[model samples]
Target chain A: MPSITVKNLSISFPLYHENTRSLRKMTHLFISGRLRQDQHKKILVQSLRDINFTLRQGDKVGLIGQNGAGKTTLLRTMTGIYEPVVGHIRVEGSISTLLDPNAGMNFGLTGRENIYLKCSINGYSKKQTQEIAESVADFSELGAYLDLPVRTYSSGMQLRLGFGLATAIAPQILMMDEWFLTGDAGFIQKATKRIENMVQNSQILVISTHSAETIAKWCNRVLWLDQGFLKMDGTPEEVLPIYLNKPYEEIVKKD
Target chain B: MSDHDPTIVKEPVIDLRSVSLSQNVKLALTDLFQGLIQWRLGWKLALLDIKLRYRGSILGPFWITIIMGAKISTIGILYAYLLHLDLQHYFTYVAISVVLWTYVNGMVNDSCLIFTSSSQLILSQRLPYSIYVWRNVFCNILILLHNLLVIIVVFTIFRIVPYTLYFLLPAAILWLVNSLALGIIFGILGTRFKDIPPIVAGVMQSLFFITPIIWKVSSLHFNSNYVLLNPLYPLFEIVRSPILGENVSASIWIAAIGYSLFLWIAALFIFSKTRFRIPYWM
Candidate 1:
């Protein structure tokens, strides 16, 4: 029953200049009629343009795009981090996002304490938190390291902790960025297994990455974005060649 | 990321255009209500804020008490001698006033950075915006509790007992409400306007001298009616007079309540209009 319906969604960020961000200058300009003139022509960076899509149960969607092509913006919008500018996104399930590994981390606290903090933020019960701690401790394999401050953790160790915590509870809809996959090979393998298991139980999965092989192996559908527009939307067989500018067989074999 | 109960099927209709003024008000109220419900989380975050700030220190949060005590004793003695006031009574008066002023100063100064300081957690997930405000309120309250030790010691040493100690409850409640209002108003403005934090700090510095904290209002030799116009006067008087066992006039209570109501109205207006844009500003 989990689904996401995005309707003509467009998001733009108002680019605040140095003077515009200052209240003193803003009030001064207002009195001089310059603020009104500036208001008529404000600068905005269009992060996402008129776009429409619907994701439902059993859908495994891959978002393929270059840097600043709005893949991350789209994911952020779906997860309710950024509001839409032109249209709406109606979400019908709980969402879990793996957008940033260091998002909620307090580096001064021990890793175990951070786990408790995050669980509390998410409104988990005491019993559920204990279970999550055990799962994260087991999955991350950072036995004694869990007692140390997270600031002392290596990048790979931090990734392990973030990944394990994010994946501890199986969500109805999972949205992930490409950075989650960057780590040691063994960790990657373990992470892939964990994601695969969650995807199997989850209603929908949306991943943004530049890896065509990853799309070929995992996604049932592909959304190729170029310069803030959805350039193509179809199966990997139909869209991969058009997006990668190569034969479908070549991209599939590359996996 | 925010996690929810999968069993409860809550459909979120994310439409910014559809968020009318009334809807914005509702959202603002819900945000405050939900935040109050999550008081435990706020308390925990506040405790950690105090703990991590003084981590590895010998006395931990007691440093707040020591620092306040030193300031009070130094200022109390020096100012009493300069003003040629009675030593014992003036010292006690300054002690209570300084402690209350520290709480007020800390709340106002910290309110500006409440949202901006937690930009990391704000951007990562969705929670009631008031939770951040409550976190700030709780942190200041924790610091106030630490500073209270100094006042307790001062009272015991002087053998001074406040007769109207019960009045402190309503005064503390008023402070809590005002702190929350300040948090929401300044929290939003500080995030949108880069100049607000410094402006707030500068204004607070001047107010500390203008308000009757170190100096008594009775010594001014002018109509205290003009002094009553200063909003902070009543706020300070309501708390300080009670602890000093002075009678709190009904007019002082009225002014404190009036200022609180004004603050909440401003806070609601600003928060409802701009709460959704906070993350984007970050």
Candidate 2:
């Protein structure tokens, strides 16, 4: 059996607004006991529709899409952050998601303490988390400042700490959403190498990124999504050209 | 040699419907399990929340102690004169009530914002939504500790005789259960309704006067039914009776425990069903 499965997933958002005229119309219908159902039919925005796929061990799948094409939504749904309005997602093993690198840290906490808190939040055992804390401190290179409150740290320092803690633990399935770039050039190089090592041993890795270069370099296969629909699925070389060369003007005009 | 007797391998059939149903169950289980694990880490996060709020200030959390002391002393003196009560006795009552009320107030105000304040964490991580509630409760306890300092100082200044230490046993249990029950209900409701916190604030302000925070329950001339009708009355009695060295009624204990358990179960049911909907709503 595949490690993870997603079938016919759809998410819809309702638009709600109150207008004086509509309220009056609703009140009139209410008094008559024959309310117009059509008046309140929700304006649905389908965020993800009929998403079907299977993920297996050693599969590095890159999810490519525009901002509103449901890239983030899909990743969140996979991590169980958001439930699908329709369909389902299954995972056979524990999954670690780095949807946002700074997700659970308290800025008031020192870097060392935040490491333990975050690692535990990510489901690491107390002893295992403490073991990783030493390594994270070393990797982040913030030195004695690791004992100071994270709120006092610069953005680069925060990124380094967040990135270090995230990449320290090995998970059965890894999900990433555009948090790969750590900003500092040196830290980026270090982080890339660390991630590469982590991914090699990871059973399943699903990454969502707008950068075609990242998909080409990191993913073995690419799943192209456009407007919440899977447009293409194949090797990076096979899908990237078709996705990049599509007529942007015509696509926007269609909407 | 094997070509003559080849073995056939068949691929598994994909049942789309069953697969989807199983996925839903798996996701639900994962969310429940995550909530349990995250509960353990919530206290640390809550401490961080408290510390962050007062960081960089010279007085630090001590400011909580100082402000509470000044407010209670002013009211204690004024009320003692107006009600013709002994200054020492009135001061002790004011000190204890104010400290306890601060904890209750903190829980009510913070419960509504638990989900809203932790939006960044909830949206990004596959964490249990209950962690926010636990964090809010834990942080309130830390603030309550700060307020305890003021209570201790007042006790010393008034030279009140030390009552039996056994008073702490029931007080601790009652406060814990009360905070947890109220936190869960308010946390769930506040997340669902945006207007709940402000309304809760208004209600609590009214409750402070009616619940004897500034006056003795014995001093009120109203019927006993009025006190019985107030939901917060048992909770106040649980905390105040022991501190005042008075006996707590068994009926009050039964009511407090019964009401808290009922609220807890209801909150759990609602939370289990609606926690998944929170990210979308937010």
Candidate 3:
């Protein structure tokens, strides 16, 4: 069986009418004037609809889409971050998601402390985390400032600590969402090696990124999503061309 | 491509049959235990939060005590004269009540926003949500400590000593339980309904008048049965009774403990179920 199976997944979000007068009319009359008030106004855009796919062990899938094409939403649903409005997802392994790399660091906490906190958050025991702390500190190259509060660190420094902490513990299934870009040049080189290492060992790797080069470099298979639908799914060589060749007008013309 | 071809390198192997969200609870509980073990870690963060607020200030946290003292004394004196209650008793009532009330108010207000305010942490790492809740609670405890300075000063000025420190056992337990229950409930509700925090703030402000924090609970001519109708009345009594040297009712203590337990279970159930969805909502 595939490591992850997603069948007919869908999500819908309700949009409230924007007109002040229409809102007043609806409230006073106990009716929905959404349709009658302004037919021209766009309302209730469907964020994700009828998404279907399967991910197996040894699959390195890259997600590509225009903004609001449900890339992040799909990742979130797959990771059990968002409950699907419809359909079911079955996963067979321990998943570690790097949806946002800095999710657990307390700004008031020192970088060294934040590392332990992040490790504990990632399900590491105190002794195990303590053992790995030195390596994470060395990789981050934060030096003595590891004892300083995270709020004091520059954005690059923060990302260094965050990235170092997350990658230290290997997970079965790894998920990343457009946060692969390491801010500093030296850290970027280190992070690239880490990603390569993770991709080699991970059962299923799902990455959502806007960078075509990134998708080309890291993924064997690519999925192209447009307006909540999977427009294309194939090897990188087969799908990247169609996505890159699309005219902006044609892409936007669909209602 | 040949076996030696770089394009066809062997895929890395990883175990895929063992991970499941069913273990989310187990992991969360484990994380909770780990946090308890590292309780000192949370206090360090809590202290940092407190210190950041007072950084560069001359009086530091003492200003909090001074301000609370000024507010309590003014209200205590004014209410005593208006209600014709003895100034000593009225001041005691206001001092203890305000200190306790601040704790209640602080927890309720901050609990709802804990997840939202800690968005950075929630998104980046897989930390247990309870850590954020506990951190906020610890911060409130610190504030409660600072506010207690006002209580000490007021009691000294009035020369009102407690009959026994044993009264504090019930009072402290009740206050802690009450705050914890509120924290859990508000923490879950605030995550679910974005509007709950504002609504709670409004309700708490309104309940301030009805709970007899400023006025004596005895001053009300209402029957004892009516006291049971007010949820906050029992909580206030828990704190106020000890300090005022009034008779602490067993019935009220039982009800408060039962209510706290119920709220704790309900909050835990709801929070555990919905915590996974918070990232989506955000």
On DockQ, the leading prediction is 1
TM-score of chain B of 2: 0.84
**Model 1 Cα lDDT, one tens digit per residue, A1-255:** 789988888777665654447778456535533232225587455667788899989999999888878898899888887866478778877788888888788999999999999999988889899999999999999999999999999989999998899889987888889887798899989999998888787889999988987788889999988767888999999998988899999888877
The weakest ten consecutive residues by lDDT in model 3 chain A span A29-38
- Clashing pairs in model 2, backbone N/Cα/C closer than 3 A: none
Ranking by TM-score: 1, 2, 3
What residue runs in model 3 are displaced by over 4 Å at the alpha carbon?
Answer: A14-45, A182-187, A245-255, B1-48, B55-63, B77-84, B125-131, B149-177, B188-199, B221-227, B254-277
TM-score of chain B of each: 0.94, 0.84, 0.86
lDDT of 2 at B212: 74
In model 2, what lDDT does residue B256 have?
72
Each candidate: fraction of true contacts kept? 0.52, 0.38, 0.18
What are the RMSD figures for all models against the true structure? Answer: 4.7, 8.1, 8.2
* lDDT, candidate 2, B125-168, per-residue tens: 76666667677888988899999888888888877764666767
lDDT per residue for candidate 2 within A16-45, as digits (tens), equals 332423767556535643332333684445
Best by TM-score: 1
Q: Score every model by TM-score.
A: 0.93, 0.83, 0.75
Instruction: Return whichever of 1 and 3 wins on TM-score.
Output: 1
